[model samples]
Target: MGERIKLPNDPHSPEFWVAVRQAQGIVGPVATDTISALIDAYEAAWPGLPRKLADSTKEKYRQSLRVVREAWGNLQAESLRPSHVQALIETLGATKPGTANNVLDALRAMCRWACGPREFLSRDPTQGVTHFEQGEGHKPWTPEQLAFASDNLTGMLRRAYVLGRYTGQRISDLVRLGWTDIDDGGFNLRQKKTGARPWCPIFSELEVEMSTWEKRPGPFLLQETGKPFTTNGLWKKLDKVREDHPQLAGAVWHGLRANAVIRLRQDGYTSMQISDAVGMSIPMVERYSRYADRKAGGQAILLSMKERKQDKTVKR
Candidate 1:
């Protein structure tokens, strides 16, 4: 054996013993809590008590987290590698590319937070993994589709669709609204994902439509008895509507909110104006206004063509 090298510290001290043990690589395993365990706790603590997230956004992340937890919950944080994450993307992406990308984003975000100051993770396992390519976000409801729902749907469905189209609020929040939620001025409510309280102004047209339903019993528009509609309940109603009308294919509730943004874009509203009207972040408003931006680009091209033709005629 080589000569003893520990001459600096007191051999009898616990500190010295810890150092000696560490020197021999005899440290215990990193925190034994599994990824699943951490995820379980995270879900429980979600939306932050005081800070709060919008209910719909919570559901979206909840679904993604549930999927990731099902796949990697038992695996140790350090055990997860880029290849493992890639495999998850491939497996999940087969059925729904968009949802697979959502899951990937959720995992990456959660793992990044875990590795932050919390030290729940030694490092982010999702490193170097790219999210699956996704198509453009939710398809906005057309004005014609809105008109159809307004005309066709008799009781609750008609109200839900029209309100969604005009207010541009999330279904989760919108369905819970009652007479008290709206007054002569406008509709007022807190966002489900973000906790911001947005007061959407009610136009005369929207007001006229809402007046027809305000006399009903509960504050909730789409209700069973007197209670607000659950997220799934609202979806089922929309699904039934789709079954009846095929023209409404591929449209979802979130898209209903986008309809207002799209309309604002067509009216040539800036990103800031749309954000103000829709109670969304400026960035989100910009994203929703992409179609409007595209239209504006075309208009610019037309203007340039006209200017060139006019210049040529004047020179001649």
Candidate 2:
């Protein structure tokens, strides 16, 4: 019965109920068109909209949609209003702003699809809902913190840190990075979030670290079991180590991406150069490297005058 229905086999889901009814050869209305039913239909609509989205994105949507279904599963899909969506967002946004935004995004996607060719709903309920304002995002690891982790973190955990620092790739792309992706130049990446293919050159520091490590058969980074880690698995493993060490409390994996930008900028790499190397947009590269750029500008201003140079020369 589970095999017949392509959706998850959870008996609590409306899809499961509908599947059960059909399997039992029962007559009458199988199920009403509710939010849960809409979700089931959307997910099952293969060669359809969900197929166009990345697996990670679809998973996120499923998570958010599950929350929506639980809240309003019994309500008719067409009857849903923007006010209801706004209230839900406000309720969740009160505590988990990020999660509330994710729910809003998921509903917007579903509602757009529903209004389009799918026609699941006549109107979009999440039409006017606004996303919650988020903070500046992940904090970059300082050079001192990076050095501490380098000296202390052991095995694959250390390798994960180094890999993130050098590659500036997302955890999703990092996990998928294999030994086969390496070449004479550097690492080859087909980013999961964006389809952009970026080439990461091997920095001297990264090469020195890589030389000390064993050449694994699969991914350059691996679990203790010698298997490639899932994105969340790697995060949890690294985060546990971060929590144990007080210096690394502020360091997150994604922050390494910003650290990479800062490092590049400090080394005289242009924003365009960093963007191309890291698979980030120029605007994002500029955003991440702003401090480095400002520092460079300040130094240039201080050194631009002959008097400052003469004073340094006199002191020397």
lDDT tens digits, residues 1-316, model 2? Answer: 2456453555334667676556667677766478877776666652454336678887898999989998898899999999999999999999999999999998888778768655668888998899998666666898799889889988877778888999899988888876688877688777887667788888988888888877667777777787788888988997788778788877888999999888988988888888888999997888788778888888888778867789899999
The local distance difference test score of each candidate is: 0.74, 0.82
After superposition, the stretches of candidate 1 with alpha carbons farther than 4 Å from their true spots are 1-31, 47-50, 53-63, 66-74, 79-87, 150-154, 182-184, 213-227
Find the 10 residues in a row with the least total lDDT in model 2. 1-10
After superposition, candidate 2 runs with Cα above 4 Å error: 1-32, 46-55, 193-196, 214-216, 223-225, 229-240, 265-275, 280-316
lDDT of 2: 0.82
lDDT of 1 at 239: 94
Cα lDDT tens digits for candidate 1, 1-316: 7556463254323354455445566696432357765665465556454566555667788899888878877687678888989888988789888888888877876787677666777888888888676566787877687777667877777777777887888876776677777655877777766776677777666778776765766554646676677778889988987988997888899998788888777877787777776788887777777777887899999999999999999999
